[model samples]
Target: MGWLKMPLREGVAALQNSIVSELQRNWPALVTLTPDLLGLEYPGETTLDFLEAIRDLTDSGMVTCEAIIISSNDGPRMVDAALTARGRAMFEPKGRAAA
Candidate 1:
């Protein structure tokens, strides 16, 4: 199963895209380290669904964000599960599992 995660946004505009896209566009530096996500404030794209477009890339192993492309010190980052829940595996509620 894919790792479920989300970026810590301060307001509405930052949370525009899903978390997956954030991983791909900012790569090589930000990296797909698994269980350790790079955090950064996300910017908006004019011609793309930044999050939905590359949702599957992260599961393949690696994904990057555009922010990491230009800078060495990136901020908060978003993740895939919060993006669209496309590859997430769900089970019964935790409380019910013990029953």
Candidate 2:
């Protein structure tokens, strides 16, 4: 896929979007997704990239995620993820009140 060849900036953006969309698809449920799971979706990204994207989304308040340290080599990685209020707002149709 073209995403596999996308530049770092575009790829990271796509990763972040994918993260949010996955949570959105599941809605109110907290989903546990390891790096391996994410890798299946974006074969182009490294584990580090997925960790960074999770941090970015969490820092931005778009999503609430928990980072689990698998080992020294793995460092801190996000596992459980769910959209925050801000994140849910992104999917809301224009002119509709947020639930």
**Cα lDDT, all candidates:** 0.32, 0.68
What are the per-model numbers of colliding residue pairs? 16, 0
Q: Worst ten-residue run, lDDT, model 1?
A: 83-92
Candidate 2 regions with alpha-carbon error over 4 angstroms: 1-10, 40-45, 72-77, 93-97
Candidate 2 per-residue C-alpha lDDT over 1-99 given as tens digits, one digit per residue, 9 for 90 to 100:
342432445467777877877887787888876666555433334666776677677777888866555455544446677888997897566897766
**Which stretches of candidate 1 lie above 4 Å from their native place?**
1-28, 31-48, 64-99
Tell me, by lDDT, which candidate is best.
2
Provide the lDDT at 96 for model 1: 44
**Model 2 alpha-carbon miss at residue 22, Å:** 0.7
The C-alpha RMSD in Å for every predicted model, in order, reads 13.4, 7.3
